[model samples]
Target: MTLLSIAGGIVDDSALSSMASNASTRKTFIDSSITIGGPYNFHGLDLDWEFSSTTTDMSNLVFRSLSYPAEAMENNLDWITVMAFDIGAPTWKPNLTEAPAALYNPFSEVSGDSEISSWIRAGFPARKIVFGLPYYGYAWKLKDANNHGFLAPANGADITADGALGYTHIRNRIIGQGGAITAFNYTFASDYCYNGTTWVGYDDVKSILAKILYAKGKGLLGYFTWRVGLDDNWTLSKTV
Candidate 1:
């Protein structure tokens, strides 16, 4: 059956942090949520708190009275979605263009494989983990159009300030209009397309299928994307 879930959160996690800090407030929040969801016939509530970094913040999350111990999680939670992308960005590595979601990376432990392995090692069951994929990509402005390759010198972000582009935009605007040269980097297990100075690193149909196969091979619960609205006529979604 298709379950309807209500997700609540903003770009920041301060509100969630505050609500998690106190037991009474937390109980009230949960009760109020049920009350709100009852009439709407919602099946579940997903807390998209963005993140909670500090030890206190983390401790307070998911009902502090009963912390999310590994054993409790294994018993209570069906699965967890591991966000495995956003590994490289202009803000993180401004000097060079890099894959935002490389499956494997020789340079550092900053790839999807590393992230999933780390979680598995940390006691989270592999079968209870759903790997995450991105339906979006980051664009970098090549310092020299002729020098377009992985780790190529980049001036910085292109098109948008954040260099983010949805799959539709990349397909229609960049690939369609500019006739971008698309290539799959087998080394990183990532896909990229470039036209002139604009270079974008994202999962196309090829990479998405590869990642899904990888997740299956690793014995993951399944795979999911960050957002569905970014898909190009449901192309990527269909592939997944």
Candidate 2:
């Protein structure tokens, strides 16, 4: 059965109405959320709670309550896919330490912390933990053309989609057509593709494989991606 996962855990003013204030409302949401799938044989929900650090209400109330529904939903479905990307960034900007860097740095301090562990600590089962891989890179418009590497300063992301460029675009258009320099950081297990003044950070085949192996080692359920369409003809998908 094809299950369409819905995005959750976002507090756009409120998640299914003030879950913190109205305790009854929280249960109502939990009850009603399941009914959404009754008409259609959809698989499950993918809880993507992004940028919870941006606000206090997000961090406190949303943080305290967000996971309950996901744990509940997991029981109701065949599977659930949780987002596990955006764990690191090279944007220490303007500082000398910041330079051009990969979006998905497996060996970075943050990645080392392992959000997956946090979920398990929060009480989610590891077998249900479908880790995520990024099929895109974060781009930065350089503040100084020559100043580029891991943690380089930048004006900001150069492209739309939060300065993101997809893997397929990086492959066919940037590297293939523009002759970008593809370099790997062995220590960190990440990749950098620089086409002239523009620098992007993404996962290459090697980095993807490395992550998959790591996940397998941890006995993870499987892996998922933030995007599949953006991959080079689903090259990353096939490889994973």
- Per-residue alpha-carbon lDDT of candidate 2 for residues 17-87, written as tens digits (9 for 90 to 100): 34535557756655666788666876554444443443444434344343444565456544445555554
For each candidate in the order shown, give its overall lDDT on alpha carbons. Answer: 0.83, 0.62
Each model's TM-score, in the order given?
Answer: 0.90, 0.72
Model 1 backbone overlap count:
0
Model 2, runs deviating above 4 Å: 1-4, 8-11, 15-20, 51-82, 89-108, 117-125, 143-147
Model 1: per-residue lDDT, tens digit, 1-240?
A: 123343333455777777888898889988988897778787666565556667787677642432345655677677777788888887678789998999989888889999888867768799999899999999999999998888999988999998989989999999988668999999889999998999999989888988999999999999878789999999999988
